[model samples]
Target: MASSSTPSVRDHASGRLKRAASTLAEDTQSLVSEIKKAFTMVKNIAVDLEREKESTKVKELETLAVQLSESCDNCIRHASAIHTVGNEYQPTSELTDFKKLLDEQFMKLKAMPSQNDRLIRQFQEAVWNVHHKGQPMPGEEEEDIVMTSTQSNLLNVKCPLSGKMITDLAEPVRSMDCKHIYEKEAVIAYLPRNGNKKQCCIAGCPKFLQAHRLVCDPFLLTEIDELRSMNQQTEQAQNVEDFTGLDDED
Candidate 1:
């Protein structure tokens, strides 16, 4: 029932996530190379012609390059998150918001392939103005990217399960089996419902015991507290400076 016994769970998950990430990286590189070859073809043929056809082909290739680049980036982030959670962090399914977080992340990772395929089909059709059906590309539709540790934006950093600040920084705890930390209150709330047999929300290692025990992450908790205190002080200082500036203007 202790978090210390979950290394095997993390190790197995790490291997699988790494393999999947590797495959994705290889596939992306191959696709990018093909697109580059198309560029070479366009350049070679354009040298002998005084026609707009060459320009059109070049522009198409450029647009496809941008799209593929974005897709590749998203794939990498998702894979990286998977590896972090699977290997470095554990997940607890018992928390109220844990599954929701995973579902959101999964949707994004799933979208990458769709976007890639759509772009490929677009390239096959014309590569420039893709006239296709079904759902549009992620950016095209204006869907917001789900924030996670993988993103650098400050707004994205939060408890993965609760989608909120780790308010209980002093008493923060983690289900070691999954390696995910949660506010103590949030975790305790889950314990009453299922007792000590809750399953983890992580993709792999769905054992109930992983969610049954909780560990106080003092080091992590202290770090979170320091960040919170720093932000609070910064905000207070900014407010005072603004007040002083207003007085001077008056």
Candidate 2:
């Protein structure tokens, strides 16, 4: 009976060992799954950080591009104005600095897009305004007898041949050549007529008598000649109207 009890105790001990081994296997599997989940989380965080870094870089580049473009535009405009003035009045020390600034800005702008048109147009207008504004009035220069501020100011004034005043003087006197002068206000009124070419209204002025002085104002004379030719052609056509009533004898 004692031998029989020993065998039963051994069997129970073996069964308990088996159950512990199964529990160990399950814990090992759980540990492996947890490690995999942690690795996945770390990978996702790394990816997000990379994307954020790239997005920040793009924004910075965009800002830099805009600043570069504006700087270039301003440089071009300033340089053009300075160059125009320099051409007419000789270059100064300030102009040299201006040109250097313009070159630096233009080099930077060349890296940007869509700046060419704006640059060209700005330069063109600046140069044109500087060169053409208040140019010599196209007409005959006459020595005028005039009184000004308690003194007689003899002026070599050029009067507009298309019946217009060139200067805005107070109480202007008319020339015998049909060049009528009034206050400067009169000149403003005459600007629209004949595209601002002041016409000489003097009766004996060659402008009205002979078409020579009339044609002196290039743009105005062109329009006047066109209108005259059109009138002549229309009158000739009207005179050629057919009179078939006398053909009844045929």
Candidate 3:
């Protein structure tokens, strides 16, 4: 005959098995949630980077357009002066040649509109490289988690932007207006030039370029390069001091 406790022992074992199964299911669900959250975060970062890349390109093109317009104006002014001189000195060969050169320059200025599409395409390509492909997203750090399973799990992670190994993922520091992620120092360095001297670098924001603030992320070096180019143009314009300096004796 079987012992009286045999059925009770079986029941206890079955209950423990059901509880264990339930715990495992909960754990798996939690892990899935975490993975989903992580992927969403990464996607958001990519989008933000893309937007900033384009914005910077647009600003650069706009600045170039301004410079080109100024050049055209200067050419027009010179041409008028040549025409006046030609009228004063009726047979002046020099004034006639100058007028022809100015006409050619004017034609070139008119041709700039045709180049706009090409310039925009080039700018878009550049923005893509800066946003993706080469570097990791700014501010994110690689992390290694020791997930204990029935066996051991190991993961080798690298930062997307810097290619550095990091133990913890860094929190994103975003530009308040533009929501651009960058290292705090880099953001600060970029903020001063955005017109407000006191605002964030965001297009159309009332406080845009008004206040300077720092956030944390890898600085978009490509954006910095564009900014440097603009600065060089500005410096050159300033160094010229007077538009008539070319006609003046040094």
Candidate 4:
């Protein structure tokens, strides 16, 4: 005797499962930070008694935290697979083959490196639609809005104010208003010239540069790291080529 509210309860449970998975993922990533804090406390205790800091213990704790974090990540993946199936799909003998195939595909997805970006985006859009109903979900870009040239390429971009390259070391940040990037220190120094909010340094740019609009460009930092790796590889190749050329001359 199933009640009329059974479907509603199932839907609610699905939402809760998704939320719990998200929270668990966040907590797992933060575990390293918590370990660092605990080690700091341990060091403080050692200082009080004038004893040597337990560096070896700290390393063991960090290793344990990393292993636990990996386990939690696997748990999140399993939970996500269950949430994706929903409550409507009942396992029957007729659907056994289909269920097996579905599970295999999920396992493959778990092993895929790009699964994080693709699956997370899909799940976020699905969750937004489920909760928001009639409202349109925000996307990467809008149809009506035109992106500026600065927004097109984030790599090796220059700070408009200082005429210097913006990299991770420069503390790069992006403007939420114009999607333009800047060296964080340069932008901060430029803003006070015209009383808090200054016009963007790029010529003909209409957006005002304010402290609140500038957010840390994490993607830019990642790109910078990749670029540095590429440059190092190129330099090594050139050195090898030069050495080979000298040997040929001999």
> Who wins the TM-score comparison?
4
Indicate the TM-score of model 2: 0.20
Q: Residue by residue across 1-250, what tens digits does model 4's lDDT show?
A: 3676776776676566545544544454355345334534543443333323454554454444444444434544543344334322343324245466448645954774422232233233333444453355565454312231012234236787777766434577777567678888888887775558888887778988887567543233433544454456458768999999999999
Task: Please provide TM-scores, in order, for all candidate models, with all chains considered together.
Answer: 0.29, 0.20, 0.21, 0.35
Clashing pairs in 4: none
The TM-score between candidate 1 and the true structure equals 0.29
Give stretches of model 2 more than 4 Å off: 52-250
* Per-residue lDDT of 2 in model 2: 79
Tell me how many clashing residue pairs each candidate has.
Answer: 7, 12, 12, 0
The Cα local distance difference test for each model comes to 0.47, 0.36, 0.39, 0.51
lDDT of 2 by residue, 1-250 (tens): 9777876775665455434433443343344344334433433443344345554543444344344444444443333333322222322223245456446544543453433333232222223334343232234122211111112111213344333333323333332234333333344454454454444443444532212112111112222323344356456645654444445545
Residue pairs of candidate 1 with colliding backbone atoms: 90-178, 90-179, 90-180, 91-178, 92-201, 93-200, 93-201
Supply the global lDDT for candidate 3.
0.39
lDDT of 3 by residue, 1-250 (tens): 3677766765665455444433443344344344334433433444465676656545555455444434433333333333323222223213346456546644644553332232233333344455464333344332211111011111212232333322233432444345433434344455546445554333344444323222221122212323344456457756776755765855
